[model samples]
Target: MSGPGTAAGAAGRAGQSDALEHLARVGLIAYGMVHVLVAWLALQLAWGGGSSESADQSGALATLAESPVGKPLLWVLAVGLVALALWQAAEVVRWRSGWSASGDTRKKAVEKTVKAVAKAVVYAALAVLAFRAATGGGQSGSGQQQQTTAGVLGWPGGRWLVAAAGLVVIGVGAHHVLKGLKKGFLEEIDLASAPPTAERTVTRLGQVGYPAKGVAFAVVGALLVYAALTFDPARASGLDGAMRTILDAPFGRVLLTLVALGIAAFGAFCFVRARYPERT
Candidate 1:
């Protein structure tokens, strides 16, 4: 009894619902791995910045660049970032492309112009960065290029921007996790479960658990920033000093453990998203 139009509509709806679920799950997986990598990088920076040893200029960038294995791993992060952007862009394009189909030609022209302009800006920036990196001009010429440390974060710099950036990423992750909680898991459940008291507790747990995890990432990122920036490199044992700083902090181990747990939870969410697919 189903007509062609009816069948087509049903197929379209199914496709859209599946796409959202896939994107959300893949996004969570990508987000988690990227943070773990970033955390490792922070440790390296802390060690290098706080060390009393001389900087390695010859293969500085090469040594730091992620390896073949690392590169593939990092592709996961790139996917999360770019896929999210493109997914959003596609939504905008879909709506606008048709709205002006029969409308004023000028409005359609403007829309096309804006999209092109935005793409150009992104391409231009990438081109510049590529040019610089290829030409060995990534670092500013500051007399011997004494190997850039976490300098901006320490002495005269205070590392405010670097630390803040990590914190901001944490905030972004929290936003996504909280959104998933509200939209993905909790919203689907029956709000009026029997045993009303248990329902409130369960609801609250779900609400706070993921968001709390995000806070953990932010906290660890902040700690790494503080250790690398504030730990003095004046002494030969300065690297040790930084490690000690972390150790000496109240409940530092506990905080690190919490960050690790957050990472694991993120991984779990990604897995669930991937395995379960999605339902409308």
Candidate 2:
């Protein structure tokens, strides 16, 4: 009786794992689609012709919501995102266990754990947003950020907290730039089985795309810092705001167009990545 029960439990767990993996795979494709949509909107903005979309993640979600089968798609996306979050959480747990081992080289372990935690947070957030969209809970990305900033500012030392958050975001952006330049993202895909030309194309796309995204993130962080210093929550722009800022710079249109193209490249890379994700 004990043996039978144990076997049944094992089978149940295996089934669950398989389901999650499938969900994650589907979620990756959805994620890629969002990025691609964002890239398209950004390009339109660069050309000085586009919808009144926010040109951010929220905008991407909104675009999907506008489709004929948008609600169902959003629901699917929400589930996939949840699966991705779970997968990342599992990674964090697994890494934490290794980090606890008696080893002098804990630095790498710590870094990986941090990365996993960050990814999990992001996946979870996206999942929430998708569910909200599916349920008709519409909210602009910039509006949401401002609301959070306002709430934070109400707290003691809120400015400092905002500043700290800005710095962290800036650091993340810098890391993206570095990762793209180094083609470090290649390690996250099954490029080993890809043809040489195909691999090179994907590498090029990532290299361009990552840096563009990093630039946008850095701009967003800078705006956040400015908002904190000025004690104005209204100034704390999100991704949409950051892109708009780029358009306000000298020769803004040209610069923005280049960035938009880079973003599009990244979107393309994401699509390829979804098809060949690294199996860990």
For residue 150, model 2's alpha carbon misses the true position, in angstroms, by: 1.1
lDDT of 2: 0.82
Structure candidate 2, residue pairs in collision: none
Local distance difference test, per candidate? Answer: 0.41, 0.82
Error of 1 at 101 (Å): 22
The true-versus-predicted C-alpha distance at residue 51 of model 2, in Å, is 1.1
Candidate 1, residues 4-108, lDDT tens digits: the string is 445445544543665544654564455444333333432443344343221112122222232544434334434443443344344344334444446576466
TM accuracy, model 2: 0.90
User: Which portions of model 1 show Cα errors greater than 4 Å?
Assistant: 1-27, 36-68, 90-209, 217-248, 276-280
Q: Over the stretch 1-280, how does candidate 2's per-residue lDDT look in tens digits?
A: 5553454355335434878878888777777777777777777787877678888888889889989999999999999988888877776655565565566656666777799789889888888889888988969899999999999998999999999999989998999999899999898788777778878889999999999988888989998999899999988979888888998899988888888888778878877776777733
- RMSD per model, one decimal: 12.5, 3.9
